[model samples]
Target: MSDIDPGQARPPRRVRVDLPGRAYDILIGAGLVDAAGSILAERLPDARLAIVTDETVAALHLDRLTASLDAAGIAHAVVTVPPGETSKSFRQLEHVVDAILAGRFERGDAVLAFGGGVVGDLAGFAAAIVRRGMRFVQMPTTLLAQVDSSVGGKTGINSPRGKNLVGAFHQPDLVLADTSVLDTLVPREFAAGYAEVVKYGLIDRPEFFDWLEWKRAPIFAGGPERAEAIAASCEAKAAVVIADEREAGERALLNLGHTFGHAIEAAVAFDPARLVHGEAVSIGMAQAHRFSARLGLCPGQDATRVEAHLKAAGLPTRLSEVPGAAIAREVLMAGIAQDKKVKRGRLTFILTRGIGRSFIAADVDAAQIDEFLAEELAG
Candidate 1:
């Protein structure tokens, strides 16, 4: 249902990947996986590749990817992981390593993460550890991975302590995004992914958010505008990653909604039955907007507008609606404390001053956060 009109011709959107020496391109278009062999061959050269994917994506598109690699004369092995955040574990990663060893993958061989964010994170982490670091390619199928996780190269597994607690900065050698796979996403998953697409607009691109406001329905329904939106979002993310590859500075800005989002995820143990990543981000962003308004960064109207837009996009926008709102503030703070941005035992929060303007605040008072949580929990 993508909007590519056979009548109109447009060059594929290309974003210069982040790492300087590791610079690559993010190829976005339809039927790209079918054309992936040439792309991978050029980027990877003679590296033997391991295709790490999920059961769902493997069933649908693994053959096409394998066929493409075969035609390119690239030796490859397919490794499938269970499709979920739960699969991002030490045990699962160990299993992948075993598969790599059993398949005789060499030290120079690369791992191809061929699914959504989970596959990207899990496989990227495995690539980082396999023989103490091998190359990896990100083939993100979901919009969330393409827009946020894949471009950044922050690969990790979740811990009971917090999400992404154990990870590394392993940039991919290349990223091939065949937007066509989105066609197979169920309505709920598609809507969940949109939450991440909308975050870039709220965090740094107010104009983009306005553009999205006008195009949400067409995007949801699948049109050319949808493809354009995906390309634009990835471009924005890629530029940010290039400027701050390791997330030591401007990269933290990308976590605008994720701090709250990750906590929501922790509160739910990352069960899709309860919540998905984008849905948590949606609710998190709405709450952060309210907190920002209360801190006098923006008017309350901004929070209302954010809430309206997320709800319209089929995302949850309330904390109380979550099952654990009644839980102690300390529990949520504990999760916030585990954030990678923490320094000297103090939490550094990314707060928005207005749409498209955000700043880091290590001096933000805990009293203010408690007050915000009280209201968020009650209301």
Candidate 2:
């Protein structure tokens, strides 16, 4: 926030997640995907890579990545899954792992996650499990993955019981976040991804939040502003991951809306047609602010500000905005109970002291949550 002036356009940026042993660079730009071979070559020369992506992203961007790799003399194999949250399943994870094994890729090879969050999580998890572990690289094509999922090492498959319930702490070797790829995303997909970008602002970066409030136009328009937003987000997340790579402490603060968002994602059964990750996070973050207000922890105006920003971004800010058939309160609560944040059968949440003042809240009362959720479901 201090270094970059929002009024003046800047350029594409890079941010590093400086973990002790798993440190990696996040290269944010427009045409970096076209440089995928060069990028990986610098890190892992003579690498046999397993490029994991989904059908949708494969259709649009795979050729560019493959050509780039081919030009750089990087040998790789492709494994494409159906594009959706549904791909984050034990079944799909096994398939990806088998595909990688069926090919010439080895444990030393990097498993390249070449799509959105689903591909990132599934591929990264497969990378983690295959032959004990393997190097991973994130080539996030969606806004959600570039700013959030693509950098962090949180990889996993979803359970029928809950979302992201099973995974590992396998970090990526490098992240090539090509901002240009966002151009191919439709409005709704882009908007859903923007929800995660907004999250960094809300998470202990008040000035950044203020910056987002004003720069929505250029940020969405895609330019230096867009790159700045992504860089700033990566910076915020990197700082947190550095402090707590395994969600033991400050890292949990990153789940500002995830506790509620994950529930929404699960209840809708991870259906992209009905809901996407960031859209659910929008509703979840709004719910968090409102829930905080109910607990006298956040001002109503602050909640309003959070809701307003999400709504203006074309993100749904309420549970009712979910597109599918009505999901029952029992189903929603069951999902919450199964959230990975739960500790020893007690629920945990990332509640806000105020905007940019989020903190981990352990053992939040079940009755209060139940009562509050009853109202959310009624709408």
How close is every model to the real structure, measured as TM-score? 0.91, 0.90
Cα displacement (angstroms), candidate 2, residue 239, comes to 1.1
Q: Give a tens-digit lDDT track for model 1, residues 1-379.
A: 1233454234556777657788777877776777788777887798999889999999988888888889889999988988887898988989998998888887788999999998999999999888889988888988777777767778989787657789888888888777777889987788888988887888789899999989999888766677788888888888788888766788777787788887777667677778888888888788778888898997788788888988998888987666543556677776777766778876777788776666677667767777787777766
Model 1 alpha-carbon drift over 4 Å, by segment: 1-11, 323-330
Question: Cα lDDT of model 1 overall?
Answer: 0.81
Local accuracy of candidate 2 as per-residue lDDT tens digits, 48-86: 899999999999988888988888889999999998878
C-alpha local distance difference test of each model: 0.81, 0.86
Clashes of each: 2, 1
Predictions: Cα RMSD each? 2.7, 4.2
Residue pairs with colliding backbones in model 1 are 3-223, 3-224
Predicted candidate 1: what Cα RMSD to the true structure? 2.7
Q: How does residue 129 of candidate 1 score in lDDT?
A: 88
